[model samples]
Target: MTALTLIRHATILLELAGQTFLVDPMLDDARSHDAVEGTSNPTRWPLVGLPTGAAEVVASATAVLITHTHVDHLDDTAIAFLRDRSVPVFCQPFDVAELTERGLPDVRPVDEVTHWRGVAIRRTGGQHGTGAQADLMGPVSGWLLTHGGQQVYVAGDTVWCDEVAAVLDVNQPQVVVVNAGEARMVTGDPITMGADDVFATCRYPGRRQVIAVHLEALNHCGLTRAELACDAAAAGLEVTIPRDGERVSLFQG
Candidate 1:
């Protein structure tokens, strides 16, 4: 069976088919804008204040799944670190040229169903926002990973929309990891999945387990883990808000 571990915001570590898969790693010491503003605090003390031993993890990774090129998801430090590694990097089509420009040798764009180390990956289109926010964020996407006879969906930074619902309808993932920070600006609605959106996403017809993250770690995001958990329970949703460095696993029946 595949194990899904939430490493951090928009980051995850999955072990399946005797291979490790790291997704959207943001492991820099001062990588977040929240740190500069003194607003968000990391849930656990970072090991050496960075994604230390990242090379070791990357060394074991069968492939790296990159959803987008945002600084939090893909930064200079991470890019530099992975450049020397031989593992293939899977990313959205728009990000392929950029990765190539940055000197990554085996960068592949995720456009359809593909497999790495016996894990099935299907890339689905995503919507970032309604108007200008979507333009600024570019083309965000999500992934459906089928491994060991089960499915898991990782929703990249997004608000509640039809595309997300469509992903749910098609994949019917048993476990879901949502970027649930209720982030907002002074002028517009929240950018990331707010508590309400998280509820809606989790309440989708066939989802069995849901894990919410991307909270209390960035300036733009303001929701707390406790708050999200409480909200989910109140909404009668089965959700887990994991502490940083914590790990969870799912098994197929």
Candidate 2:
């Protein structure tokens, strides 16, 4: 059975195709790092702690998938956690050099589709922000994981745009994972999906599941699960906002 466990922030433990895949693990303790410069609500990063211990968190076998190398997505503790292990690290081309430099033995860049043990992981494009913010934020990638008759889309740090629309129209994944914290810098628009964007994703014409995450962890993330839940419910939109450590089914609901 395909399942997902939200570890914290943008981190997730995904079980699919008879293997476990850890995605963008940020395993540091609460408030260990300072706030991201220029972002609003200048509080320390990772406002909360992981639901479980790091060792227990990553004890399962399989590989690691990193969408980007942002501190919130990939930190020193997480890097140190994987250094001695022999799991394959799958990442976008932009992160290959650094991840390898960090001493990860099996660093693999998924420029496009990467096949592994009957699973297909396809790299999809996205805009982290608009204009200068987007450019400065650098390149981000979402991932489409397909195995047999099931498909799951892990939409990385991104806003609602043509690229996301195309992924929805073309891929038609039954389960969609969205970074919906509405995070932003000092003086710009939201860098991630807000309530409107999440609603847009849920409103897509089909039967599927929209899982909204990236909330209540960092200071810059202005939106909360309570807020999103109320807004979505009022708008008659369907979404699953799981708490940290909660395991969610990958099937459409």
lDDT of 1 by residue, 1-253 (tens): 5777666677778776777778887776643343322224433322223433556555656778888887778766678888888888888988998999998889988788788777888887776755786776688887788877677788888888898888888778787778887866545566689888888887778746777877766666778888888877787777778776667877654
Clash pairs detected, candidate 1: none
**What TM-score against the true fold does each predicted structure earn?**
0.88, 0.98
**lDDT score, candidate 1:** 0.74
Tell me each candidate's RMSD, in Å, in order: 3.4, 1.0
lDDT of 2 by residue, 170-241 (tens): 889899999998998888789999999999889887768999989999999999999999999999988999
Look at candidate 2 and tell me the lDDT of residue 129.
84
For candidate 1, what is the total of clashing residue pairs?
Answer: 0
Off by over 4 Å in 2: none
